[model samples]
Target: MRPNIVVIQADQMAAQALGAYGDPAARTPHIDALAADAAVYDRAYCNTPLCAPSRASMMTGRMPSDIGCYDNGDDFAASTPTFAHHLRAAGYHTALVGRMHFIGPDQHHGFEQRLTTDVYPADMDMVPDWRRELDDRLQWYHDADAVYTAGASQATVQQDFDDEVSFRTLRHLNDRVRANQAAGERIPFLMVTSFIHPHDPYEPPQEHWDRFEDVHIPDPAHPEVPDPAQDPHSHRLRAMSGFDQRETTDEEVRRARRSYYAAVSYIDDQIGRIRERLETLGLAEDTVIIVTSDHGDMLGEKGLWFKMSPYEESSRVPMIIRGPEHLVPQGRYENPVSLLDLMPTLLELAGTDPEVASTGSPEEEIAPARRGLSLLESARRERSGRSGPEDRDVTIEYLAEGTLRPQLTLVRGQYKLVVCPGDPDQLFDLVADPSELRSVADAPEHAEVTASMRAQLEAQYDLRGLEAEILTSQARRRLVAEALQRGTVRHWDHEPDPEQRYVRGDFWGALQHGQIRIPQGGAEGAA
Candidate 1:
């Protein structure tokens, strides 16, 4: 039988910060130990860097464009079939215990249970307006003050929420274990224990903050950000994020860096507790554990603060999979895989195929997931002491708050391409310049490679049509958001169904078996 699945997902954590990833500043002993026993993917990235789109992609096993999730406000259509639905169809109980950053009202998204509501507002309030200029910034944009104001916090809003997430997850596990024991059954579970720590506001708990007190935190490789006028995309992000308004001293950067590292360690501590609880219940041996982040923090790298840009710091995420010793392979894989692949990957682990599941959906809407290969199969091949088939092409999309238009990234092996409106194409050779300080698009030595990648990107995406679709989406969402935010706001926030009963019938199988037709503008679909 397939083991239970536990997803410990983090927010805004960069791959560079983990000791497992060779960061000297991180105090993540727990994560390092987990990596030692798990299979690590060195080049895994989120298809879209922003919170909602990337997370939506991971959940549904589809690209953001496939699901029409361009920004945080883009509602993840309930019509989509998620891995939870697949697992649930296979008799696994699914639950989410923390922040999923789901914007719409239908927050359960196939999870049989959700322990808490999300931290961010669950509406179109955060919708980005391309028509709005820099001075007319969105209300949700970052303040440079967050960097300057960084320090140890006795208590913070994020810490409190994550603490509750951890508690609820542990309590849920204990409940399940005892309930299963009393019932004399080892019921399967797919639990997502997510956390919002190690995200920005860069203020960690005082104790975890003190743990890194003596650690030397380095400033961003290029602390001097580019001029906004010259690099419109970078400048737009910098200005909208409010980084353009402030001049900070070295002290501010150091304080922010230290706090971020401490924040990572704080979450690492929580991971230890959750893992210990799983072991205590004798579930570790039969559970498949996954640790990853939605996206990465810039941490002042290249003068960027948060995700949204196509830079490596913002695009890449950390991923580790620790499954049953006989199943999961150890050691690192240096090929490019994406969070977009998670849906198919998890589905395969649960003993179903994405190809079959794609055909199972009522409308056959699960196409993008079929595009990604499962890492479970790949890991098994690697365990036999042979290399697995390599997929070099990774497609990344950006249509969030930062840009007036859309952006795309096509990464093939060492050369990565980034193309957006108003900025010249950027191509970086990661093997040659890992920091991505320079774009060799203009170099004659790499003309053929750049041209080839550009052709691939253009062939893959229709820029004019894609931009039109995005604009239409933005306009529609903004119009709806405007009329809805009158004297009273109808919240789309998901409240956990207090009656946590598990229905035995397959959720997806009902669709596959054609027993139920998914309703149009389903009860939960309307704003």
Candidate 2:
């Protein structure tokens, strides 16, 4: 019989924020305990930093750009292959308890069922008739309320909203066990329990926040950020809504960090509850429990509030796997890995046939163009002392509006290069400067290193068949218009009123028709 799979994923969680990862202030005893039995991957990274794209990539085991899910509002194509589909084909009972962020028609994918949760549908960007009646000012206020109210501080809100997601998941597990007993057959389950805490408005329950309030928080090593003139991305960040140019004092930074830690702890507690239930049901030993996150939060690193950059803080995440002792050894893996590798690894563990794995391929016999290898195989090869195949260097590309091209890519070895279309390139030696405080791109002594990394990046772009041209204003208008027409709009602040708000499609039409012109070039494209 195959082992059951349980994936407990947190949103916007950074590995370093956990005590297991060496943060003295973190209250992640549950995850820490689980890590004791699991193989802890120390260098796992998200393919993209934003939620939609990152989730899409992990679901399909494909890069965001490769699949065209380049930003938060972009929808995953319905025909895209996903792990859930493959697992269903292999005869496992599949289900998602929360937070798939599918943004398309096939919300369930191949999952036999969705227990129940608030899923931001694919049409969320479009303006509904009820919302269209409201005026713009009223709509903006409504949106603000919706977001601020949903931010991470209130215990009532957290338990009422996210905790239910956990409860439903646990109930599903219990039902499965009961059904198996009744049928006199052993069955495996693939369940994903996703939570939306630790991601935003920086709020945590009062008690959790108090636990870390006294803990000392370290200010960024280089608080003196680069001049905005030189770093346009930094400048644009300051200009964004909710981001102010005022100096971030040590006290405020510490306070924010404390809240973030509290949020993580809260999520950790929920995970602990789920694990306890699993063990009580006698399925712990036979189950493969994978804990990870879609991406990492910056927490004010580099004067940035959220993800989208190629910095370590924004790109790196945590991946822990615990199950049958023989499958995953307990230790940390220093080698780099990508979340895109999870699908193939899961398929391998589930004993999925090669034909099921090839479902999404144009030629069923040919394997998909996967850039990742199975983590289980990699671990096995390493344990045998045989020199495994050379690790493929990973790369990330960001193509936000106003940028000349999707020009940021990080080669896994030790060098990172940031290309700004129509501007000088920035290069950093991550081995020496992990914080990326200095750019050695122009240093005469490091010319050879810079040249080598640039060549690798260019070669990767060529191999991927990427077009490096910046989007023309007209083109941008057309794409935005298309998104608006196809997407639904939900106000975060006020009640839904169609008369007061512009529908996504109508908004896009206005922009395309020259009614609105968004400012570009400065910090507009910063992550």
Candidate 3:
């Protein structure tokens, strides 16, 4: 039987913020435990740092620009064939729960069902306008308020939405198990439970907040860089988010970090609950659980508090895949991987004969230039004491808010090249200088490596041409967004089917079969 797949994602969670990824400040026991027996990717990154584009890349295994997902407000066209569609085609039931933040119509995007609505808007309201002046702040841009007002909260919109996500996720898991049991057979499932916690507002519940009350929360390694000394992209993000105009004290930074850590812990607890449910339902041995995030939150690194930057704190994400030992290897991989890889990884995991993988022309679905290798194969090679592929190059893009031109990153071997159109190219040897405090782009000794990587990056993308395309997309979306606001709105948010959820009259029989905590304890009508 094929293994059941569950991908639990946390929004804007940095690899540096998790204990599994070597963050001592993180209180994520469940995630760490999962990492202990899973394939932990030490160098996993999102193809894009922003939320919508990053997820779009993950779903389609294509670069954000390739699919026209330029920013938060861009629509993920229903025409796109996602991992869900591929898996479903391979005889798996797929569902989405919680925040996907899919903009525009067609919220499903090949998902057979959605148990909860998205936390953010599903319209083009949050689109970024590249036509505007670089310094002019948009209505939906990030600000320093999330940092200055960070703390524990009794109740918040994020908390409420995440709570609903957890509830519906558990219910869906149970429903699947019960349905399979009733049919006297197994059906593979691909469910994505995405949470919006730890993203912003920097407010976690008091219970999780108190866990770090006495613990030491360190400050940013690199303090605020003067405007003249900051990198072009970082400087753009700072000015775009009002980071230059604001004054966040040390205490505020600590509170924000503490709250962010608390939110991570909260997400960790949710993971624990999902695992426990799987075990109780006798699905643990046949289920593959993937823990990761769309992108990383900078927190207070270099005085940047959010994503939309190419720094490690904002781009690197934790990716852990846990399943039976026979199916998954137990080891950490230093090879760089990105969200774009998940599509092929998931398709390979769906079964021995997934339609997309067996087609012999996967490029028909996933373009060759944007295609990613299967990490599962890489793990198998690692377990056999064989060297994995040598020519591994992971690319990341930041084409969303907080920039004048596109920021493209090329991670080849140990060196990373950050290139913008006019700004000087910035390069860092990740192995030697993990903190990326300095640049080796102009160093004569490493000139060969920098030049080669820069050539490869430039070859892969036409930055100026891409920028013009992005500008055109932004203008078109802004016009649509404005026109929609003036008329009677037809919201595209997903509304859970009442007939398919809970103990509704139409769903009573199915709900009862799944609701029975004790097997054959009593009849359905018996109190």
Q: Over the stretch 115-232, how does candidate 1's per-residue lDDT look in tens digits?
A: 9989887898778778888767767786778899999998889989999999899988866765565556778889998899888899899999899877887779886675444457
Q: Residue 340: error of model 3 in Å?
A: 0.8
Rate residue 351 of model 2 by lDDT.
Answer: 88
TM-score of each: 0.90, 0.80, 0.94
> Model 1 reaches what TM-score against the true structure?
0.90
Any runs in candidate 2 off by more than 4 Å, and if so which? 119-121, 124-152, 155-159, 227-230, 241-245, 353-370, 384-390, 401-404, 462-527
The CA lDDT at 133 in model 3 is: 69
Model 2 clash tally, residue pairs: 37
What candidate 3 gets wrong by more than 4 Å, as runs, is 226-230, 352-369, 382-390, 500-512, 515-527
Q: lDDT by residue for model 2 over 395-429, one digit each (tens)?
A: 66665422334656665456777765545677777
> Against the true structure, whose TM-score is highest?
3
Model with the higher TM-score, candidate 1 or 2:
1
lDDT of 1 at 158: 96
Which sequence of candidate numbers ranks them by lDDT, best first? Answer: 3, 1, 2
Which portions of model 1 show Cα errors greater than 4 Å? Answer: 227-230, 357-370, 380-390, 497-527
